[model samples]
Target: MVAPLKVGIAGLGTVGAEVVRLIEAQQSILSARCGRGIKVVAVTARNKSKKRGIDLRGIDWMKDPLAVATHPEVDCFVELMGGAGDPALSSISAALAAGKSVVTANKALVAKHGVKLATLAEKHGGALNYEAAVAGAVPVIKTIREGLSGTSINRVYGILNGTCNYILTRMEQEGLSFAECLKDAQRLGYAEAEPSFDVDGYDTAQKLAILASLAFGTKVNESAVSVEGISTIAAEDLRAAADLGYRIKLLGVAMRTKTGIEQRVHPTMVPLTSSIAQVMGVTNAVTIDGAGIAPITLVGPGAGGAATASAVLADVADVARNVRALPFAQPVAKLKTTTKAPMERHEGGYYIRLMARDLAGTAARIATRLAEQKISLESIVQKHPNGGLEPIDGTKKSSPVPVILITYATSEDAMRRALQAVQKDKVISGKPQVIRIEKN
Candidate 1:
């Protein structure tokens, strides 16, 4: 048998500690699979006294994190550290510069500086693998980078954030308010103390950038994605979605358009019958649309110690097996400079909700505004009034009623212009609620 492949690990957090335990428990299986034993030769963390439920016997303990990356006996460096800068960035660069293969679960690091690190890895003849970076254990990265290599991919999208998904699912199923669901998520440890990163759409945006690069053979562009959070999604929006045969999900979408690549992360309305809608409560689902084959959707647990560690081990095993592939599934020189497609150029169906005075000819005015922009409505629904209004000056009082309109395929620019015209007519109250519709 070949000598055991030595590994070094940094950041022994939830996922990192589990990775150590898992490698020991599955040692025999991994060895058989890779034709050699996989061993954790060294480890590092913030506190050495922290009691992790794993034996660290016979392994080198490093006080300084960077030493783990450049250790003499270490064949591969596993960075479970979660950060976009500092130790994570400098350490990974040191590992590649030392000609050591790297496997990391840091999406922020990969999304922000993937091309430069990838180029460094290639220059040093080192493999850089990150199966656990996006969507946890879903293996979506490998599926795009290898499984569909020969095909031409048009689009890749999915529910990439588990915290937002859990909140949205609870809101829809239990009819809870956004705040209520968010509190529940925090209690359940699904959300962080500071939840803005996940709930405000930046986490999903980072993951989408990595997926876009793999799917389109383009350089990762974290700043290019248009992002919107689930903070403003109300119970009424959920009710409206269900009434229209759809379910609301926070989605990260990347598509190739005529002008360039379009990447967006926002709350979306997908058909109730769609497979992605069926994925609920902290689970994730990713779909890849490629030519000459039907769309393929991969759904599974998006997070947790065991799931993420399993993904990390898979990449480690691949490295042990001497697998060599570019980080973006194509040569760095061949990767094209990405042109960001403007949101105004997006063509799609939309769900628009407006509150207007309950009076005759109000709907006609809205229709006229839409018509002026050449936006055609697929359906118009006028919900019942909120309540009877009190009479003022002995005149019949009018209450505001909810008017919901589903538009056919139209440009976002046209929708915005039409809504501006409608708002100017003084028939509407408050800002209009608009959610984009995804047919597939």
Candidate 2:
């Protein structure tokens, strides 16, 4: 057999150690598949003596992670050190400069600096592989890069964040509020103690930005993607969504429109019967709409050491076998930025919940506002006496009852204007909780 490929690893946290474990566990299979043995020869972390739940015997220790990437001892550089810049970026630069293959699980790095990195990798004749970056173990990147190579993909979108999904699933199933469900998720270790990144859809947005560039052959534009979180998804919103033949999910959407590309991450109401709706818990799923071929979807464990490590190892094997492909499934020069259209111009259905005065004509007043905006209601539910929660204070005693309405497909701008009018009325208390519904 050819000599084993020496791999250098940086970061021994959850994903880092898993890569080592997998390399050891799959040694035989990798040799057979890639025609070479593989081994992790060096590792770097803050503390050299730290116990990372794995045996660190016989491995070389590098105090500075950047040294590991630049060292001549390894043939490939594996970067599990996440973050868009600094050690991760600089170390990756050193690897590419040395003409060594680099593999990473950093979506933030890719979303923000993928184009430049791809350019550098190509310039140095170094391979930049990141199948693990988008959706943990799913070969969505590979499928689009290889399996569906012939098709022109127009849309690449899905549920990309597991923590958010788990929380949202519990909120609907247990009829708990967002805050309650989130606290439970944190206790279960499904979410980080500081959950802003996951709950706010920023994590999903980062992954979506990377997916958009690959699927559309466009330049990475993290700023172009609009993002919304699950923070405001009330229990009533989830309950009302269920009654409208839909289920709420934090969806990362990327689509090719004539005017420009539309990218966004938000709490979306999907048809209750769709396969995407049925996907629950800490699982990541992505669906690609190929122009001619059948739409393909992949869903699986999207986080943790075991799953993420599996991805890093697969990338290691590919580089060992000289798996040659474009840095981002396309040449950098071929990649262009998709025109970015505003969210208001896009057409979609919406869910609106309001606390209004219980008096007569209040409902008619709200309906007239919707008509003025050219928005039509697909369904309306006015609870004569919504006893579950009192209408938020300050509204007139004659305020309309808790009014929930599902509007037909309309412009986002129109919906916002209509909602503004509804909330401004003294009879209605607080802003009408609104969530958009997508047929997909």
Candidate 3:
């Protein structure tokens, strides 16, 4: 019989502790699947005395993450301690250099240093599996890496961040402001005390960089993505989107363009009928559009200890089965470098909400500016302050009117120029709210 696969886990936090519990609870199942038992031989955490509610009786407690990573009896090094640098990076590098397989859930680390780490794993002939890094338990990494290996991927986009999704969902359904929903998200433990990372779109950008690399055979470049947060998304915008037969979502989109690959994260207006629009709350979903096959969407819980630990264990099972795949789905040397596609040149439909000053010529001036830029409007709606439609030629009033305009496919440059001219003309009361329209 094959001997058991020895594992050493660094960081006994929620996810790390859950991984241990899972391995013990599912030993027979894991053994039956892998043809070998998976055993946790060592572990290390900051405060070992702190009760984690897990029985660590027979397992060895190492002094630090580095020690756990390079433990003599360990065959797989699992890094659950999150950070883009330091002990996590050093430990994973040491494990890979020692020809031991490694598994991790650190998206920041993978996004920033994935190519280099993949190079190390490739040269040392050890597997570098990080299925938990991208979409929690969604298995998107494996689907792009292995399942669609033969198909040509044209686009990969999704609702990658749970906090932003929850906020947007609540704002759409209940007409809550972004701030109110974000506050509730923190109280419910969905967002961090300092929530800028998740709220500002950096978290989704990091995850998108990794997905773009896997789907397009490019080097992981987080800076290539143009990120826009959900902080500026108002309840009015969500209401306008719903009226336009669309739902507002914080989406991470990566697609092949004529110039190159365009990756971006922003509050997008997806049609209410789209698969991604149906994904609400803290759940996650990813849609992959390949050349010939229909769009495949995978949906599941994107966060939490149980969901994340399930993905971490999937990587460990691959290691136990001695299955080694290139970390980014291609050789490090073969991965091409990618630059940030210019957002100004991006082409898409737009949803523009202008709080027009209650002046007689405001609407005429706005239309003239858009016409000058060759922007064709799909539709337009002007609403009074009391949520009633204002007559197109009604008498002017003192309060600013909400003018919502949906435009046909146009370049971002044209939209910006037109809006700028309208702003200079002082036809709008405040800055306009713009959300890009993403087609299914």
Candidate 4:
């Protein structure tokens, strides 16, 4: 039998501890499948004496994680110390520099510096695998990097943040406001105390950047993605979406456009019948649209110790079997420098909600503005908060009525200009709420 693959793990957090437990539990089967044993020879974490619920007996402990990565006995560096900077980046660099393979669950690290790391790994004849970085326990990365290697992928998108999904699902299901849902999420441990990263859509943006590169064969560009969070979503918006036969989901989408590749993370209105809309709660779903194949959607738990560990272990098993592939499914040099599609040029259907003055010709004036920009409306609805148009403030001519309009496919630039014109006409109150509509 071949010698076992020795792994050195850095950061024994929830996911890391679970990785160790999983390896120990599945040792016999993993070894038989890989034709060689996979063993945790060394481990490093913030606290040496911390209880991880896994027996760490007989394993070497390293005070410095960098030492584990550069250790002579360690063949693979499993980096769970997630950060875009510092010890994580430097240690991974050192590992690849020393010709050691690396497997990481660090999304920030991968999304920020994937190209450079992939270059380093290839130059040093080492492998770099990170299946847990994007959608946890979902094989979207592997499917795009390997399964769809021969296909021309058009669009790749999904609900990438579990915290945001959980909050949004709670809001829609319970008719709660965004603040209430977010509070419940934090209390239930679905969201962190400072949930800006996940709630503000930056987490999904980072993951989308990595996925976009793999799908479009472009260099990773995290800064190019246009991001919007679910924090601004209100119960009224959720009710409007339901009435329109749609569900509001924070989606990270990347696709080839006429001008360039478009990557964005925003609250999107998807048909309730769509598979992605069916994915609720903390679950996530990724849809791949490619040539010669129907759209494929993969849905599963996007995060958790057990689910994330499953992905990490899969990467480890690949390394154990000597599975080799380019870090981004293609040579670093061969990856194209794609143009960042401008948001103004984006063409899509939109759901526009506004507080319009309830008076004669108000709707007509709004329609005139859209017509001037050639923005065709599919439907227009005017409804009062109460059952009738009676003014709540005891005024007959100036009651603010809710106006909802769904427009046909139009350029974002045109939509913006039309909305601006409508605002100038003084027919709407406050900033209009606009959400893009996705057909799938």
Model 1 ranges with Cα > 4 A deviation: 385-397
Question: Candidate 3 at residue 317, lDDT?
Answer: 99
For candidate 3, write residues 1-440 as lDDT tens digits. 99999999999999999999999999999999999999999999999899998999999999999998889999999999999999999999999999999999999999999998999999999999999998899999999999999999999999999999999999889989889999999999999999999999999999999999999999999999999999999998887787778999999999999999999999999999999999999999999999999999999999999999999999999999999889999899999999999999899999998888988788889989999999999887787567644445655767887888899999999999999999999989889999999998
- Backbone collision tally, model 3: 0
lDDT of 1: 0.91
Clashing pairs in model 3, backbone N/Cα/C closer than 3 A: none
Task: Summarize candidate 2's per-residue lDDT along 93-194 as a digit string, tens digits.
Answer: 889888898999999998888888898889988889998998899888888887778889988889999999998899899889888988999999988999
Winner by TM-score:
3
Estimate, for each residue in 74-116, the C-alpha lDDT of model 4 and write its tens digit.
9999999899998999999999999999999999999889999
Q: Across residues 51-129, which tens digit of lDDT does each residue of candidate 1 receive?
A: 9988999999998669999999999999998899979999899999999999999999999899999999989989999
Q: Where does model 3 exceed 4 Å of error?
A: 384-395
* TM-score head-to-head 1 vs 2, winner: 1
- The per-residue C-alpha lDDT of model 4 at residue 328 equals 91
- Candidate 2 Cα outliers beyond 4 Å, as residue runs: 338-340, 384-400, 425-427
Q: For model 1, which pairs clash? A: none
Summed backbone clashes in each candidate are 0, 9, 0, 0
